[model samples]
Target: MIILVAYDISDPGRRDRAAKLLQSMGLSRLQRSLYAGRGGAAKARDIARALERILDSETDVADILVLPDHAWSRRIEVGNGRARVPGRARPPGVHIA
Candidate 1:
């Protein structure tokens, strides 16, 4: 499953730490302050909790988005489409054409 993590941290140190934490959990950065990761439910949840601890009260705001695997097919076929939402883009990580 793919999980999207978006954060708007004012502290540069905190922001970088969050990004690194996500990356360590197999997240490939999509944009500045945005991360995309793929992992099992337990791992994802654990990572999110760890990040929360790191941020503590310094985080201006953060969001851990758990994406539904059903929405994503095995690969992006010919008819595979895209969707848009607030904050960041839809598909954040590697895409197989």
Candidate 2:
């Protein structure tokens, strides 16, 4: 139930705003422009909805990946020295909807 949230926000102000909103929703800043959290489907949905509201105010592209429990233990890392939570069992499964 660890969710990986990534953002490609260009505006610092809006990016900070979005980060704050996500943090308020129980997400921890795991790396720059990346967030992590553990929650159920309802919480995930709520976070997605709130993220959309924040992203709507800007031109940034934000994505959320609901990582399954099985992938939580897998050791995959991103470029910025942060471990990657399996975003999807299949490639390009980023939940933007």
Candidate 3:
């Protein structure tokens, strides 16, 4: 399973905290506010809940997308960056480990 976590935090402190939390969960940063990792359903839910708790519901927004192996296989990339999609052949420069 692959999990994509993205967040928008209004406060700089909270934003950094959120990034750190995600990193601690073994997620790799894909962009300033985007992260991806591999985990089971339970792990994904736990991470989502943890992120939700760290966020200010009134001011922050976070999204967690779970992609099964099949869904990830259909992903297409066209650019100069790396994408970590588990259980799939990655494009050049892409890293999935």
lDDT of each: 0.68, 0.70, 0.77
> In model 1, which regions exceed 4 Å deviation?
70-97
Q: Which lDDT tens digits does candidate 1 get at residues 1-97?
A: 7776788888888888887888788776656776776766787678768877877565477787766776444424332233322344345324654
Q: Candidate 1: what lDDT? A: 0.68
* TM-scores of all predicted structures: 0.64, 0.70, 0.74
**In model 2, where is the ten-residue run with the lowest total lDDT?**
88-97
Q: Candidate 3 at residue 77, lDDT?
A: 52
The number of clashing residue pairs in each candidate reads: 0, 0, 0
Per-residue lDDT, model 2, residue 54, is: 69
Candidate 3: regions farther than 4 A off: 81-97
Ranking by lDDT: 3, 2, 1
